[model samples]
Target: MAKKTNKYIKPFKNIFVFILLMFVVWMLFFDANSWLIHHELNSDIEDLEAEKEFYKNEIIKDKKAIKELSTEEGVEKLAREKYYMKQENEEIFIIEYQDSLPKNKEK
Candidate 1:
């Protein structure tokens, strides 16, 4: 009876050790927090890439605008519209809208 019991105990102990090792591996490598962190990193990388693309497009637009403004006619048009400069004897009239009022209105 003792010999038979000893034989069965060894196999049961081996199986228990194997199960414990598997549980440790799963917790370290396949747990919920690990997966969540990996997913968040991927999403952050995607967002940064989108922002980089937006800035790249903005740079292209700015370069084109600069090229246009370097020309004589484009410079004249910008000055007239932005600075309100006109030809001699031309009058400048300013229009004010309620929605366009300054932030601080003292009255």
Candidate 2:
């Protein structure tokens, strides 16, 4: 009986020690804060990459616009639309939107 009990107890002790060691290792290296921080850093890196891609596309668009503006026709069209420039005798009219009024009656 004593031998049988000793054999069973020995196995249980080994299992308990293994579990304890694993728990210690997990607490030291795989805690909640470490996982959270890693996830946050990953998200931040993803956001930065997206921002970089957006800027890259914006640079391409700006380069294309610059190339277009370097030509005479493109410059004249831009001036006509943006600056409202016209021929010497042309008149300019300004129109205001009704939505530009304040929402509050008191104001």
Candidate 3:
């Protein structure tokens, strides 16, 4: 019986086709502008964009807080809530529920 060969095998045997395939592989993986490098750079850009959006939101929130704190009422509210400050001759009470407290895990 004659040995069987596929018709498609001839293309791979051509020197130009092999060189072109190598060049394509080199450009995709080994060149300075490789696909892997581009993918990493694109991911970095996406991360930076997300971080930029986060900082922008934070700046807006900070600006609003600054605007609020510019007033006397805002300062009193922040002091009462955060610092638990009380006016002279006034009392302060704080209530905490069990579920709101941190749970302890014991081994």
Candidate 4:
């Protein structure tokens, strides 16, 4: 009958719509280059930008330190601390007591 055929057509149309909707959802979320992937890439870019800012600040600090090292006292201090350089006939005595100190217990 015509009524029976019309009922079948309606269900088929609904199924087609559902399939199209699912396909769109799959493409938006499950595809290789999807919206979620773009969001992750944006987050990665933000993190890299933050790291770039941190490195820029560090570079500024290093330039300041290099400028200071150009002076005589700063160079001598750096040599004594890092390379353990001593003046002629002067002895260097390093006293390490931090390891011997008692550590505080956490409550």
Residue 62, model 2: Cα distance from true site in angstroms? 0.7
The TM-score of predicted model 1 comes to 0.56
lDDT, candidate 4, 1-107, per-residue tens: 54555764675478788798788899899999889999999999999999999999999999999998999999999999999999999999987798887898977
Error of 2 at 91 (Å): 4.2
List the lowest-lDDT window of 10 residues for candidate 1.
Answer: 1-10
Task: Give candidates' CA RMSD values in order.
Answer: 6.6, 5.5, 2.8, 5.9
lDDT string for model 2 (1-107, tens) is 54555664675478788798788778656887565678888999999999999999999999999999999999999998899898899897877688986578674
Give lDDT tens digits, candidate 3, residues 22-81.
Answer: 999999999999999999999999999999999999999999999999999999999999
Q: What residue runs in model 1 are displaced by over 4 Å at the alpha carbon?
A: 1-33, 94-107
**C-alpha lDDT of residue 64 in model 2:** 99
Clashing pairs in 1: none
Instruction: State which candidate, 1 or 3, has the greater lDDT.
Output: 3
**Ranking, lDDT, top scorer first:** 3, 4, 1, 2
After superposition, candidate 2 runs with Cα above 4 Å error: 1-33, 91-107
Candidate 2 matches the true fold with a TM-score of 0.57
Candidate achieving the largest TM-score: 3
